[model samples]
Target: MARQTPLNEAHRKLGARMVDFAGWDMPVQYSGIIDEHEAVRTAVGLFDVSHMGEVEFTGPGALETVNALISNDLARIADGQAVYAGLLDERGTFVDDVVAYRFSPERILICVNSSNREKDFAWMKAHAQGVAPVDRSDDYAQIAVQGPKAAGLVQRLTKTDVSKIGTYRFAEGEVAGVPSIISRTGYTGEDGFELYCAAKDAVALWDALLTEGQQDGVKPCGLGARDSLRTEMKYALYGNDIDDQHTALEAGLGWIVKLDKATFIGKEALVAQKAAGVKRKLVGFELTGNGIPRHGYAILKDGARVGEVTSGTKGPSVNKAIGIGYVPAELAAEGSTFDVDIRGRAVPAVVVKTPFYKKP
Candidate 1:
């Protein structure tokens, strides 16, 4: 059976079509994928992202524990800030990509993938050894309000001042009488806010936001649009763009790794890999002739297999087919030519800079 989010009823009330996704009954679309996708790029859209996992780190050694566990430096982030980072095994293989929220001097929250909640928590706990209190918080629900007008939409509904919050910053406040954590961040590369609130108040908060933004063209968005929007920005999707088999060094996420900081879980392995140089690297491409590039399609260089597509889609905003894939570092340069084997036919492709589609 698929788990339903607290806002499932609210989605249904708005005529959203629900589908089983990663063990959760999530909305695939409300009006249509393209419409919702464009609405977000132009106006605003709300997404029920309660399926994401939230892990809490507490105790005196919490900072030290995270510094040793993640590839990013947790000590540098100030309170009420967030950082995009990855958890790697001892061998430098990615365990999961996460966003760490520094809520206070002693409290840090790590948001992870829903499917890997148990495994990620267990891994962190086991690695803690005599570190901090790592508690898995599955009680909170999350929602993303995104697009160009997303900030205004959220500001209108909440009494708290959001004007001062900069990007990647968060504040604890109440929205529509529901206690919430409003973060100035989003996956869609838009000006938006992600609200973390109690599960019991999720439904009411969703309804209140929708009602407040009804006049401003705020539509109930779904996973389909969310995926499309993120793809436009070429944001790495965990299971697709990255995985346990791939190292952060090979995935173009080296910026998140703070090797200069204290010793980390995969520090030794990462240090060796960095010294040796990475082999295969993640790159972006655009379909030249036609046909959308789908995941797992073979990437050919000079009629020989080089790599494969990981994430692809025809971006609604750009009106062009774009994708991310792994290929040899030599062939990863921008403008390098390649071919995608789609249905046994070769389709022309070119290595393009990431963020295939950027919001104007």
Candidate 2:
């Protein structure tokens, strides 16, 4: 049986086409993937992202415990701010990627992908013997408001001044009379806020936002549009872009690693790899012709398989087919050309700068 989010009924009322994703019944599209995608690019679109998992760590050793789990340093993430980092195995393979938010001196929240929730919790628990208590709050519900108009819509509904919150910062407040965590962050390459509220208040918050945003062209968006938007921004998807076999270096997340900070899991291996060299690097590209690159497609250079496509989609906003893939560092430069094996037919592609599309 697939788990349903608290806003499932609201999605149905909006005539969303729902599907099972990683054991959760989620809406894939409402009016259409392209429409919703464009709306988010130009105006604003709301997404039910309650399927994500949240774990809280707070105690005397909570900060110390969290610093040992991921590749990045938590001390750099300021109070009320969030930083993107990866949880790694001993071998430096990515266990999962997460957004760590520092709420206070002793309290912090880690948001992770849903499919790996249990595995992540178990891993943290086993390693957090001396750290603060790790508690799962999967019952909470979340919604993301994304795009240029996202801030405007949020300001109309929330009591706090949206401008007061800096990027990657969050505040505890109310939206439509419902207590919520309004974080100025989003998956798309746009200004937005992600709302976290109690499960029971999920539907009410969703309703209030939709009603308020209706005149501003706010539409109910789904996972399909969300995926495309993130792909356009070159934002990685967990299962697709980063997996257990890839490390932060290979996955293009070296910026988050803080080797100078106190040691953490996979620190030695990362240091070794960084000192020596990395085999491959993640890069962005666009299909040259009419074909659309898909995940798992073989990337060929000089007629030899050199890499694989991780995330690919037809970017509605950019009106092009774009994707992210891993290739040798030598072949990861901009304007580098390669062929993606799409259905056994080689499709020409060229590596371009990341964030294929950024709306101004």
Candidate 3:
């Protein structure tokens, strides 16, 4: 049996096509994948992301406790801000990628991927020095409103001044009479807010947003659109693009690692790897012709397999076939050419700058 979100019934009512994703029954598309994808690019779209997990740490040294576990420095950001980080094992490979939200020194929250919820809790519990983490996944339902007109549509219902919340920031407020944590963040590369409210309030919030946002052309989005949207932005998907086998540096997530910030879980290994240099890198590429690269497709160099595609798509927004994959650092430079074995037919491809589609 698959776990269902609070908005599962609502999604069915709205004619959503549901599919099993990470052990949850999630909507794959509402109108259509391309339609929902373009809706977010041109106007706005709503997503039910309730399956994501949340963990809270509250008590003295809670901030210090969490900071010691992840690869990013949370001390750099003030309260009400969130930082994307990696939870790594001693080998410097990812345990999971997470977003830490600092509310105060004693109370910080981490939003983790659903697939790693239990694993992360066990890992954190085993290594906790002081404050223990509490799983809050059941307590909240997350709804993402994204695109150019998202802010204005949401602002019409809430008096919290959503515009004041800059990117990577959040505030506790009432949106459509429902208490929520309005976080200025999104998986899709769009200007938007991820509204987190109580599980019981999910239906109300979802209905209100759709009713009010009708004027803004907000469509009910699903995982299919979400995957395509993130892929176009070159944002890594945990299971496909990143896993325990790949280190953060090799995954092109070096920006989140703060080496001088002192002893974190993977600091020693990351430092050693940094000194020795990453032998392979995850690189973004564009197909030269008509083939759409897919996950597990072999990446060939000089007619021999070098790596495999992790995330690939025919970008609806960019109208081009683009993909992300791992290759030797020497073959990762921009314009480096390779071949993707798509369904046993070698398709020529060229490495290019990431973020295949940039908003005009």
Assess each prediction's global lDDT (C-alpha) against the native.
0.88, 0.89, 0.94
Best by TM-score: 3
Better of 1 and 3 by TM-score: 3
| Backbone clash pairs in model 3 (N, Cα, C under 3 Å; residues 3+ apart or in different chains), count | 0
The lowest-lDDT stretch of 10 consecutive residues in candidate 1 is 129-138
Candidate 3 per-residue lDDT over residues 213-305, each given as its tens digit: 999999999999999999999999998899999999999999999989877998999899999999999999999977999999999988899
Q: Please, what is the TM-score per model? A: 0.97, 0.97, 0.99
> For every model in order, what is the number of clashing pairs?
0, 0, 0
Pick by lDDT: which candidate is best? 3
Clashing pairs in 1: none
Off by over 4 Å in 3: none
Screening candidate 2 with a backbone cut-off below 3 angstroms (N, C-alpha, C), the clashing residue pairs are none
TM-score attained by model 3: 0.99
Candidate 1 segments exceeding 4 Å error: 131-136
